[model samples]
Target: MTSMDLSFRRSNLLRNQPIGRGDADPLPLLLGQLLLRAGLPTTIERASSRPWASALFEGRRHSIRLHFAGEEPTTQRARFIAGLSEAEWRLPKYFVADITVDEEGSDSEGQWVQLSALTIRDW
Candidate 1:
């Protein structure tokens, strides 16, 4: 098997949920789970409703940071890189970004809150 094939197999093992088979976004899912672990309500439709939203979502700033060990090919890593790249490309062309962070580092951390500011109004 090729290195890419081996990497993919390893990545899938680390995933909690299967790929392309969930109703909700993975990032949001993780955020919800984190909130629950912190004794906060996780069932809320909007993560912004929680107090943490203020810290994550400011006026208009979004950032995504990635941290990983030495350069070793893995399926999950490859998928993550590809997926995030796709998200970034689709972001500016199709979606509006209040803020976004695309960087790589060892000590990476970030937060994003879902705000209700943007909404469709009947004209």
Candidate 2:
């Protein structure tokens, strides 16, 4: 896996808050880490996110579509899902509460996997 520096800049809305008390969206960064850990040669077909918050916690619900093309795409797709499900992710300022394969299918050229995840800020 390639090394990455995952840093978040405080949103202007939280500028007046105390240090370490800001919310920076982590979905984009988290998606990169998720792809890396899966270890599949693929492209992100699409990504979507919606903000979510409760009385105490703030986070996002994410959906990602990945396309895998080449030999044995079915096998590669299986491994991709397994990798994400089994591996433990240690990301900076974020917690991946859940990640799962929501849908999958194949066409003449390749296979695609759709994943859903819930991520929360650690700060």
Candidate 3:
């Protein structure tokens, strides 16, 4: 995976109070690390929410769209989902949010597994 520094908008501590727990800004970063550890060539791109999502869950503003590539598509997808499940387990205090992963075409690495995570800033 190529290395690059990416930054996202963080909620103001005193202003933007969250609507629920597990809305911290750290989930995506941890997710990226998980993808890397799985040995899948990956890239996490900071992204905006779907129009409908942005309208409904305005409080959860941070979205991360990560792409993973591997030789075996099924194995890689399973690994990623397992890692994400572990992450969700780590945050037992919060509600389990829905994360979406899809197959987005191929590159030099083989198959591209796209995962999007939407999280809220700490309030």
lDDT string for model 2 (1-123, tens) is 898545655564376443355566677787777677555677888998877678988778889998888588888887777767656767677788888888999978799989888888776
- With a 3 Å backbone cut-off (N, CA, C), the pairs that clash in candidate 1 are 7-74, 7-75, 8-75, 61-99, 62-99, 62-100, 62-101, 63-100, 63-101, 64-101
Looking at model 2, report the run of 10 residues with the lowest lDDT sum. Answer: 12-21
Residue 50, candidate 3: how far off, in angstroms? 11
Residue 34 of model 1, lDDT score: 32
**Reference-based lDDT, residue 42, model 2:** 78
Q: Write the per-residue lDDT of candidate 1 for residues 13-102, one digit (tens) a residue.
A: 687444433222223433333333323211223333111124434222222223232233233234334433223222211122222233
Better of 1 and 2 by lDDT: 2
Top candidate on TM-score is: 2
By lDDT, the best candidate is 2
> Candidate 3's residue-wise lDDT over 71-108, tens digit each?
57557656666656446423322233555554455566
TM-score per candidate, chains pooled: 0.22, 0.73, 0.42
The stretch of ten residues in a row with the least summed lDDT in candidate 1 is: 114-123
Q: CA shift at 37, candidate 3, in angstroms?
A: 7.0
